[model samples]
Target: MMKSASTASRSSAVHMAVAFIAMGGWAAFANSAHPMPGPLIAGVVQGTLSALITLFLKRMIEALSARYPGSVGTWLPPLVAVLSSLALLSSVHWLAGTPEIVRTMAVPLSVTAVYATVYNLALRRVAAGGVG
Candidate 1:
């Protein structure tokens, strides 16, 4: 059974929300372990921003998939989304003066990469008629 666009979008939004909370909680806990000020707030901020970024990236992937249909289209979008999101978030973190810049960026980037990969694979499988 195929899902309508609205249904798929809703499902993606839910997944993004869950990813945001999980990643945010982990980041907050990790930051608290370190001697940083306002760890909880920082974590929340990072997580929220990261989740938004992921959402945008997913949208980009969808657009690209539509523009270029084939294996190239299927695989390239996810890779581009991951790399672009990482760069954008890292830049944002640096400009925002986030403490432990590398570590902070790492948490979200790792989350995005994992999520994007799984998301892309699932999308491809679905596009291929659910044949894994």
Candidate 2:
């Protein structure tokens, strides 16, 4: 049984929403000192980043679905993990007034994009060999 286009889209949407909410919740809980807006923005940022990463995975999944249907669910969460980890690692800007907390939230985001682009272009050269 193959998933229709709409089903795949809805499934992806749900996954994206869950990823966004989870990251926002975690950021909010971990850093209560910062304002809610930053965490909300961070969540949005994470969702956006993860969505981009998903595009890459879609290709691999399409090719593999015929061979290993069960692995789809198991293999997909790591992309979410990558997104959450990237979001947590990249927060550099302070909330509007909070100066004591210094982190490069945006830097990680920019770096993630650069790395993502590089990944898309040169995945065969680096990611193919496994963790560096």
Q: Pick the candidate with the highest lDDT.
A: 1
Stretches of model 1 off by over 4 angstroms after superposition: 1-17, 33-38
Per-candidate total of colliding backbone pairs = 0, 8
Error of 2 at 120 (Å): 17
Each prediction's RMSD to truth: 4.6, 11.0
- The list of candidate 2 runs beyond 4 A from truth reads 1-10, 55-132
Error of 1 at 107 (Å): 3.0
> Could you give candidate 1's per-residue lDDT for residues 1-132 as a string of tens digits?
357756766786776687688767766776676666556755776778767785687777667766776888767877887779777766776666666666766767776677676777777777778965
| TM-scores for every candidate against the unseen true structure | 0.70, 0.35
Indicate the residue-level lDDT of 116 in model 2: 43
Residues 1-132, candidate 2, lDDT per residue (tens digit)?
Answer: 257756766686775565456544544444455576655555555455455544444455334333433444344433443465454444422333322222423433444445444444343333346553
* Sequence-dependent TM-score of model 2: 0.35
- Cα deviation of 69, candidate 2, in Å: 20
- Clashing residue pairs for model 1: none
